[model samples]
Target: MEEEKISELKDKLEREKALLEEELSTVGERDIQNPDDWVAAPAEMDTSESDPSEQADAYEAYGENVGILHNLEIRYKNVRSALTRMEEGTYGVCSVCGELIEKERLEANPAADTCVAHKDEEV
Candidate 1:
């Protein structure tokens, strides 16, 4: 990829990284031991004062937040990885095959690690 195009994609990836981190913060916190890992924030509820039904509801909400956090964390990791690839001069290269990834695919997903031909392959 041209330096200018790579720079633009890097900017986009950085913006997405920040947005994902901000959104993750609302429902989770970065792990102390593992900066890349995120743990969902527990729902606020005074278990001692709340009824069993209320406690169950709180747990359910916590579970939902965990699910959301999991997805956001995955995206965050992908964005970070893409940024790293850019720094390493490997951006726009397909991870599954040693070939240049399609520009349109990259435009659609700047964090993509595979070309359209190998997109369905496991990274």
Candidate 2:
């Protein structure tokens, strides 16, 4: 990739990373042991109501947040990995076929790690 293109992608990736972090912070906290991990904030349960149904609702809400957090964590890690690859000079290569990834694909998603042909394969 040209240095200029790389710089532009770098800026875009950095901006995306910042936005992801901000969104994550609103719904979860970063894991202490693993920097790439994030956990949803525990929902506050108001026990003063003495209603078992309300407690169950809180748990369900918390469960949904956990699911959302897990998805965001995966996306965040992929973005971070892509940024690291950019620094390592392997940013635009397909992980499966070792071919040059399409510029359009990279423009669509800077965190993309594979070409369209190998997009379904494991990273």
Candidate 3:
């Protein structure tokens, strides 16, 4: 990729990283021992003094947060990995095939680590 294009994508990735962190914070917190890991935040409601229905609601809310946090964590990690790849001079290469990733694919997902042909192969 051209230096200019790479720079543009770098900017996009950085912005996305910040956004992901913000979203992650809304429903989770980073693990103290593993900064890269995020755990879902427990629901804030105090159900101990409340009725059974309130306790159930708290549990349901926690479950929803877990699901949301899981998805956000994946995207956050991918964005971080993409930024690392950029620093290592391998930003636009497909991880699966070692080929230059499609420019459109990069534009569509600046955090992409695989070319179109190998996108499904990426974890």
Better of 2 and 3 by lDDT: 3
Per-candidate Cα lDDT values, in order, are: 0.93, 0.88, 0.92
Model 3 over residues 5-106: C-alpha lDDT tens digits? Answer: 999999999999899999999999999999988999999887458788888898999999999999998899999999999899988999998999999999
Candidate 1, residues 64-110, lDDT tens digits: the string is: 99999989988999999999999999989999887999999999999
Model 2 per-residue lDDT tens digits across residues 61-117: 889888888887788888899899988998999998899999999999989999998
Model 3: CA > 4 A from native = none
Model 1, CA-based lDDT: 0.93
Query: Which is the better candidate, 2 or 3, if ranked by TM-score?
Result: 3
Best by TM-score: 1
Off-target runs (Cα >4 Å) in candidate 1 are none
What is the descending TM-score order? 1, 3, 2
Question: Model 2 — which ten-residue stretch has the worst lDDT?
Answer: 114-123
Models sorted by lDDT, best on top: 1, 3, 2
Cα deviation in Å at residue 18, candidate 1?
A: 0.3
